[model samples]
Target: MTEQVPVTSEMATPRRRKVFTIGAALIVLLLLLAAGTTFLWSRWTHSISNDAFVDAYLINVSPQVAGDIVEVYVREQQRVEAGQLLALIDPTPYQREVALLEAARDVATAALEKSKSELAFLEEDVPLAIAISERRLQIARDRLAEMESALLMVTRDVENGVRAASFQVEAAKAAVVLSEEDYVRYGALYEDRSATERRFEVATKSFEQARAQLEASRARLGQAEAQRQRVPITEHQRDAARGAVEEAERQVEVARLRRIEVDVKRRAVVEHRRKVTEAERAIELAATEVEYTRIVAPYDGIIARKWRHLGDYAQRGEPLFSMYDPDFVFVTCHLGEDKLDGVAPGNRVSIQLEAYGEPFEGRVLWLGSATGANFSLLPRDLSSGEFTYVIQRVPTRILVDRDERWPLLIPGLSATVRIDHGPGDPQWVEEGLRWEDRAAHLSERARD
Candidate 1:
């Protein structure tokens, strides 16, 4: 091929050494530049923390009622929607309780209705009976008044008749006495021929008539005296009427007492109504228990673990499954305190997960108020004056932006986050622009 030239060892060594020295100097220069750039980029633009991991809200699903598990409808790592059925407990006992309480409620309600009807009837009937008794009492009083008035009239009539009969008897007696004297005188005159036979006969006939009139007057007086007996009879009738009025008043009092019975019945109705209400409450509680038998998901999530199985007995408040919402995931970073000077909420971030090669876009969510060491189980005590100053890290949260590759991020994954708090182009962008310019220059020289 090419022409070959022979050289001495010293000349060859110096030339080789110069080439080697230039190569080493170029490498050293490159390394120093890279180091300086990295230092400047980190100090001026961003804060980095490797102590970061993905976090989410983990929920443990539990049952609210105790029973035997009748069915299990999910498994570990299964995706579920809100209100999806997870499992079922035995509902027969709860159903039976509800049915029993419902029947009791119906019975109590019926009893309440009966009591109400009885109260209504009494409300109408009792007042009517009282009115009837009062009416009877009024009628009896009126009758007594009539009887007393009649008795007074009869007594007056009897007294007047007796007085008139006595006067008539006295007049009749005088007439009899005078007539007898006249008859005797006429008889003597007839014997002495001073009077005729007709005169004597007239005197005797006059005496007979006067005597009969006296007997008739005496019979009238006796009849008038008998009329006094009617007074006692009228008094007896009036007394009987007064007794009737008293009896009617007693009946009215008895009827009014029946109102107490109505009050008692009303109380019974109230008691029955209370029983019905209690039974209804029991039924409602039982129905709620029955609904508790069906275990449904509270939100859309993925089941992380299944703690119970079919036919297993689960107590109240026992864990049935553990799940988490993947859509609400974020990263928690423990950043050194000195590096948080420019870091703040809403700053841009780049996250690199250990499981993936590409970086994810994120934004600063919030910063923790206390360092991680403050939440330790046994925090170091500094009051004893024996202390070593150590750098503390503050917990910071970064919200990852959702993308097509979001599903690959899981909780507890280790990640390295770079939080950009500066307001200019990043170091990588400037370096890329410089390299592009150099490449263009080289291309132009080649073309020339």
Candidate 2:
């Protein structure tokens, strides 16, 4: 070793200053690193998902009627508008069915008309019959009253005549007796010569006249007795008239019951009307079937598949093609459960489509309440045994921005999604990376 010289104060002071500066710089670097790590960790708030796909409403088109395919106006990958005719089934059979149904309807309508006409006739006839029967009943009642009154009058007159005739007969008998007595006295006087012959002759004549009067009175009394006997016959006749009145009343009731037939006919008309309505409905159904021969697009979409061709036999409800509406295209992403705390609807999202190799603007439109595993064919059954916990993922819907200038995004396209959770700009991550690169360079320099 060589002999050492004594150190100066100036040199020692400069060395101390240099050591102090290095220590200060190290402390500053350590503080910067701690601050940078904390800032970066705080800013790492975004949720990323690569398990995403573009989705749309896939529509399955089918024929409503079964028939041979007659015309096909669209093919695979064809763009079509809503209500555009896609194909047509053979309409001959449906047309025939419609014709048959229309004929049946016509027959039903004619039958209904006939029933109505018959009902109308009965409607008039039933009341008219009832009226006639009632009038007959009234006439019978009137006749019965007349007969009764006549019977009463005849009875009274016969009784009074019999009484008068009996009195007359009694007086005539007395007169006859008196006349006979006078005749006998006159005869005696004539025989005895106590009176003249003329006087005796007059007494005889008076006696003969009284005897004749007595005979006439007897005849009138017999006639009066016969008339009194006929009074009971008149009563019997009145009773017969009363019976006639009762019969007439029954006839009126029978006529009223006869209207029930008209009611039955009305019911028949109603039944026929119901049948006609059924026939009309059948016709409507036939017409509907005829209309169903033509298949029309349900919405505006592109035909992704075609399952039938012209001249191919198709059945009802058979799927003919697959299509979808373009207006509702969106991305479906599966997000981790832990990542959902910051993701919500209306948040802006970044979508990277695998097919286009570019990013597109999107938004968080919807989020599923349950994870995809819950909806899978074999869901988790924790109750079966000991379990390994899995951080389930929630399904989220991202609506891609619709821009005609951009490429058309179809359904089922694989896409990556990055959802922005906070208002922090994503560019800041890059800025932080740049800051890290500068810090790393500075550290290397410090090491060197």
Highest lDDT scorer: 1
Instruction: Tell me the lDDT of model 2 at 137.
Output: 95
Candidate 2 on 194-230: residue-level lDDT in tens? 9889999999999999999999999999999989877
Model 1 TM-score on a 0 to 1 scale: 0.79
Question: How well does each candidate superpose onto the true structure, as a TM-score?
Answer: 0.79, 0.78
Which segments of candidate 1 are over 4 A away from where they belong? 1-9, 12-19, 22-26, 170-214, 334-339, 368-395, 422-448
**Candidate with maximal TM-score:** 1
lDDT of 1 by residue, 1-448 (tens): 9997878897799899999999999999999999999989887789988999998767778887899999999999899987799999999999999999999999999999999999999999999999999999999999999999989998999999999999889989999999999899999999999999999999999999999999999989999999999999999999999999999999999999999999999999999999999999999999999998988777778898999999999998888998877776788999999898888777789999999999999877678999999999999998999989898999987778889998998999999999998543345445434543654453333222
Clashing residue pairs in all predictions, respectively, total 0, 0
Residue 177 local lDDT, model 2: 97
